[model samples]
Target: MGRRKPNETMRLLVATFIGIVLGFFLGVSFPTLSLTKLNLPSSLFPSIDLTYIEDKYSGLSTQALLNAWSSLQGKDGSAAEINEFNESRIWVPTNPRGAERLPPGIIASESDFYLRRLWGSPDEDLKMRPKYLVTFTVGYEQRKNIDAAIKKFSEDFTIVLFHYDGRTTEWDEYEWSKNAIHISAPKQTKWWYAKRFLHPDIVAAYDYIFIWDEDLGVEHFNAEKYLRLVKKHGLEISQPGLEPNNGLTWQMTKRREDSEVHKDTEEKPGWCSDPHLPPCAGFVEIMAPVFSRNAWRCVWHMIQNDLVHGWGLDFALRRCVEPAHEKIGVVDAQWIVHQSVPSLGNQVRPKALIALGLSFIDMVFTSLSFKSCQGKAESGKAPWEGVRERCRKEWRMFQERMSSAERAYYVSLGIDPPNSTTAR
Candidate 1:
């Protein structure tokens, strides 16, 4: 059987060689007259198909494009992955056949209450969007003062309350509160809430933003009149001038009895290095600062999330607006009295108020940090004192951060900052 097998293999090899020679001779004889062109049997020699490859890579096949897209999105290349990718990017364009039609680009960045409708004519849903937004970082203890301030604002203003005491439902007793937005976080400050909730994109619909403390008395202040003067003066960042005899701090922010508005004032000797700089000209306290939309966009980005007290932010307000002395000022015609009522500093819990028996020196050392008084018996140091100390620490930290950031930015540009020792 083995001998017969070897003889059969040899015979097959000879036949294959003869067939190949005959085919090569036939191809040489008639190069153009090939198997595909000839009327040959259908199954004798299957034709090589290039149609699929040509059609698939012609431009870009749908499946190939989808596979590339899935890879770009870091998804497994599968039919399910393609569907998920499309779902995830519903607002963006992907395919011409099933691409989503989008609204105006401006409308995408600007938002309002238009989407909150249950049922209404889409065109008539918002007859008028508020031009201004006023936000108060408040606790329930100051509800009366908050109500008074709310009354001073017209319907053209949108009211937002950041509840530090975790009290929100009680404010709803007022009719206006039902329409206002309420954000509650226990023992948090306005800057903390603003950094999280009042993002530039979230409040982009408003023309101006009023970030005020809860203790202000807005008795003489009229929102409409304030904005009118703000526009007239081209004030990109401002505040209702502090009543001269009230909780006034900076001379630049004190209201003048005779003027419609005041841009500059003579501060205490040595308080201001430049007449055009802060405390003398371009200054507004953080207590009741108003920011134009463009200015707030810049200011919002500048807010440090951890600097909850916002102690040094008043000094940095000038950074958000150009020609700071000219564009930042106090509106005297519409002024608010800083009530100076304690709100945040005294918000310690009953357990936290227990007096610590530590000595004066110990209290002094403990006062340098916010959490230093948590359990230590620091004699003569009140809970509010610890809070105040934290405020001071945060102020120093903010100043250092700004200086360091400025130095680093200058170094990145391969230049030294003005007045820097490195520059010399």
Candidate 2:
């Protein structure tokens, strides 16, 4: 086939987009539309059914959308509620003791429930559950990732921002519309926040909990459909299928637009050979994993305090879900791109002087980089060699620590631990 003219191609693209928009409106308007007749591709009318949209999208009912449309004509005259929780809550005087007035017998500075949030509050009272409570661990150094997440999820889901840099002052510039919860800490990985702040029991009110990296491209992801696919296929823990050209590391994650969802894929030999394990089994990279409420309860306890990078968790996820090959998987119906932005670790540490840029101090810290530089020169290894070696060492250490803990428990019970030679 020959390529079309530029003007013709643009017209066709615009027309297709208009059709999609029309289809969405039609689905909402025509209540008679049958779920049985909507057998289109996963990329097409996958959401012609209400089950997926109801899970995410805050379950905005057809009547609600219709009401919003009707209100567009200046009919209802009542402002639609936005940030309802905050609106309903009452604010008290900041200086409790100095206040000239106090309500009846109410204690000063005790007008609202605030401090218990640290213990992980449930959202069950909200009437509708968000498919996932999106948690983004950020340093506030780069605004792009955080901004994208807030923009996409603020309207529909509960967003929890974990600030590692502890810079609450800089957050005002971002217009969150008071829809997100902002928590700041000195420095802690996303896993640490999950283990401490987002206890699974507390978050059981939500259907799924998305523990994800800050940097991602959701251009092709449909959160509602992603939830539907995971629930439909019984995936306890899963991640969106990643774009192949997005610097992804495994074949199982690479998105296949033709498939609605994929649990396994053909991978190169040596990636994992069990066939029951990943890059094939019920496992996905932690870069962006969505956990079912029950599964998150198991995963939460598995996170170790000192293993900050979480290098070894993916391989061991099977321990949390039985028949792991069937329960842990990836979604291909709609996918996301891994920005692969190194926003998490080693942000300021230098491995070599030659790689340095001009500092405002007007000096290159060659002396500070001396040991690493000399070590690399003598060993004929790249700076990445050190990182890879360190990752391997940490992974080994984490495994041994887990095994030793189990062994100690067995010893205390007057019995030997399972044979280490057979597995570890």
Candidate 3:
């Protein structure tokens, strides 16, 4: 090829430079072309207004809009708060970064979706503020503790009590403030039965619901601040009284071992400790958790599984919170005391052992029949067979660990190691 003239080359280079500058301007000026409203399925969620888009896009160039949208999608306070408000029909005029609307369907800044949903609609009247419904399952023995806790927190929140026996006579015997609602549950039901029996009315009557164990005590609990935080953060499930270092010990199968280890590793703080994980994984003891209306609805439906009963409440909660990708906040600002309860095996002794053995067998059978493993047998592998093997390994590990721990505890208690065959 012949060499181009110097003048010709210079002209071509200048033209290319101009084109690039123009392209950059155009890209920034018009990043997103049209705003379409998606009529989401009724089963998924209700329709949301595209009110805040114009505000977000008003003065933003294409590049700025792109950056702003990307930033708004993450878990930062602005994004979370805005998303929460949108769920509640509140409009935030700008994106989380305080950018004017560059897109439609965006929410306002400083909005709390949890509060919006709970309150349902805004009211001009202050006295008609939304109330809280607190529900729990209690036996006759734990009444005093429940009563004391309620009385202490009564001024802070509206209290609603649910008795497992479904009898109102006992509840009526004690005079309480006008704000408290006491309802009875049906007399003989499965163990994981509290939410379903009590939720419908609670959901209808209250802006938020708190589910708890009856044996819990509130010494330094701040119900107002907790409620305010829930409203501000737009959290679905908030656990205020969760013990920082406590959680259930699952029998880890091999498949679960990796996950367990990964979770445990994440719990460690660096040289400077992170407040998020203070020596625990899992969650607060299911002793007390505050649930927004949306959370209550989600959890109530998930808790309906027949396989879940008295002992599996925590497992059921994990499935609900994790799969939905919803936040389960544990508040450490306030504290509530839980009277430690015996383990399932110890609670009922020989009877509980038989029940636990049967439950374990049922869990194994259910895993085998699960739909995910339907065709795995053709490949000479069973889906849950791996889980079973893992469980066996976990059982052995747990036995060894527990034996050591028990021996140490017994020694501290000044008891001699038992020679009984079942003692291990």
Q: Can you give the TM-score per candidate against the true fold?
A: 0.69, 0.57, 0.41
lDDT of 1 by residue, 144-247 (tens): 88999899999888889888777899987899999898888777778888899888878888899999888888889999999999999999999988887775
Q: lDDT: which is higher, 1 or 3?
A: 1
Worst 10 residues of 3 by lDDT: 252-261
Winning model by lDDT? 1
TM-score ranking of the models? 1, 2, 3
Model 3, runs deviating above 4 Å: 1-130, 155-158, 165-167, 177-179, 185-195, 198-205, 232-234, 243-284, 305-313, 316-326, 341-424
Model 3 C-alpha lDDT per residue in residues 297-381, reported as the tens digit of each score: 6667644333323233333343345422224455555556554432111122222334445465445333322211111233464
Using TM-score as the yardstick, the better of models 1 and 3 is 1
Best-to-worst order by lDDT is 1, 2, 3
lDDT value for model 1: 0.73
* CA lDDT, candidate 3, residue 296: 64
lDDT of candidate 2 over 1-424, digit per residue (tens): 9989999999999999999999888877764543435655666754465544333343355676666566466444445443442244334334343341344346433221122233445653344435458888776665666686656563457778777778766777877724567777765667767777887656776678888777778877767767878889999989988989864667888888888777777777666666777667767887789888788888888888766656667777777888888998888877887765544433333323236553422121222211111122227754434444545555677778777887998999999687542111
